[model samples]
Target: MTSAIRPPAAVLLPGTGSDEVFVRAVFGGPLAALGLPLTTPKPLPGAAVVDGFLAELDRLADQYGTLLVGGISFGAHLAAEWAVANPGRCAGLLAALPAWNGEPGPAPAALAATLTADLVAEKGVDAAIAQAEAGSPPWLAAELSRAWRGHGDGLAAGLRVAARRPAPELALLRGLDVPAGIGACTDDPIHPAAVARAWAGALPRGEYGETTLAAMGTDPESLGRATVLAYLRALTAEPVREGPLEGI
Candidate 1:
């Protein structure tokens, strides 16, 4: 009897202003169940965050050799960019809540990040959190409040940096040889599902999956399970052409 091949270890990065705790909550259990140990790194401050994450990825790659890498929202964009730059060094990619592709422009996620930064800068964290909580869903409000508070004054600078950073170009995405799973939230304006669909369509080996931010908020494990399942399916299938695919 043959033993199963173990999947590569996975490293999951959190969204902007979020810490490792949040990512662990969302991805830890499901990935662990799949026999893949998960690593969630706490982000750095300001313009250093992306650079810091890439450096961490490099360190992990040197240690593990072509491991699975993934992230949520802005973190997802960073992961994609790194994967594109370091081809053959990624076992697979799990992009959850991809905010935009290529140039940042007027993408809702960037705009919202900028606006939230301004609010935090002008009105202070407490006031900003109160206003954001009043307008946001309970889950989002809670997450933001904690993240914002944890980030403190540095949150504004980090948000500004994230707002301006470019996403991985579609042409680059089209060149990826590794399997990819894109997890999208159907009703999330800041992290539009259409962006995720476009990403799946662009990748040479990609599959798409849908779950709402609300659903993820209620059950963080849902995002992890959806993405892992989609990635597993993509690994078994032929490299998909650029087009719409049935959601996972």
Candidate 2:
């Protein structure tokens, strides 16, 4: 009996305005358990430069050979897009808290636009961080504040890039045959459970799991560990065989 080969690496992508540190914490250890390399490039460019994100995935597919791509929010949508186009090379996709089909609502965009304008003004990036973090959950606020401390003024420009990026289209997601896992949460107002169900339905065979950032972020390690284990289990499960069988 021939044994199936496991994916050689897992490329993790972060959500909007988030850095590699956050993505790593979400998938690093589970990857370690599977003896797989984890790759997370820098935050993707703005809507005008979205190809940078695609290019990184393309490069990883070329280098890794049967790669499993995963992401959160916008990153998840992008991962799904790449998996669809390069199904032969992709092992599966793991997406967490995906957003609307394409483009965020006006509320998030307005916040991002405000931060961009504030950074350009005299008060500097510190003022913008303080303003934005004020309304966020305590753990998230702390993480964003830390990023600001490290990157200073540059973080403001990154936020604009994040806010303006578009989501993947439904046509892009409907025909994929690879295994997929949709990680969702109940408390997240932006990521509706209905969307998760829709995405799951599109795949030939996909798994759905639930989680919350409020709990996950509080202890970042737990989220990464849980996500990776869930993903590995799904990927190793049997694929949905198509075109009639001997038994049928």
Candidate 3:
């Protein structure tokens, strides 16, 4: 009997200081339901650590013959960077809550990583959660607090790495012909709508949408599934003549 044909593989990169568990709960669950060949979500190795995360991606590309790259926040930024570097082998890019596409400032992830780690170390998870919840939607604060507790050390390390992460240059993403789907939020302080607009203005194929941490946690599976569907469709489909990033 012939084996069943699998769908193309997707590489998921989590936000800074995040691990597979949180990413899976928030992003992977939905993408997996689509029946795509999904690889395990992985953290991008820090420069200091020098783990061969990029090399693994290269291997996956060779083994699968094609790949779709998707990420959240810092993950999204990295995905864009990788897509720019490897346009031919990449199937597409799914960038969620992309931060600082071309802005000149510290990368949000670096700031978040350091601050989150500091909060965790000083106030403990419960206190940190409470503090964050003071301003953030309850659901997001809760989910992230849980993540903070579970991944404090890694978060600290990632913060250190992020603090040094340079702002992503436009040249890295400009003129790339590959299709891309970008998800943004209306209320996220870190993920400004203007940033999304800028990204839409630059990529060859870019679609913009909205999401929130509270909404995401309320129905992570549904949110992730919808996002993956949108991303996959964008990946296989042709670019729309007037997408968000058309003029750029």
| Most TM-score-accurate candidate | 1
Error of 2 at 197 (Å): 3.3
Compose the digit string of candidate 2's lDDT tens values, residues 63-110. Answer: 877878878776787788788778898887777766656555564433
Q: Please give the RMSD to the true structure for each candidate, in Å.
A: 4.2, 6.7, 5.7
Could you give candidate 1's per-residue lDDT for residues 1-248 as a string of tens digits? 99987668798898888878888887787677667888888888766888899999999989888879999999899999989988878999998889999999999999988998898889888988999899999987898889888888788888999999999989999998888988887978889899999998898888887777778778877777667666766887854432333221
* Model 3 lDDT per residue over 97-199, tens place: 6778555366554566668767766766577668778977776766677655655455556556555554356666666676677777666777676676567
Q: In model 2, how large is the Cα lDDT of residue 211? A: 64
**Per-candidate clashes, comma-separated:** 0, 1, 3
TM-score, cand. 2? 0.77
Off by over 4 Å in 2: 1-6, 44-49, 103-123, 148-157, 225-248
lDDT of 3: 0.63
Score residue 7 of candidate 3 by CA lDDT: 62
- Model 3 residue 202 CA deviation in Å: 1.1
Q: Give the TM-score of candidate 1.
A: 0.92
Comparing 1 and 3 by TM-score, which wins?
A: 1
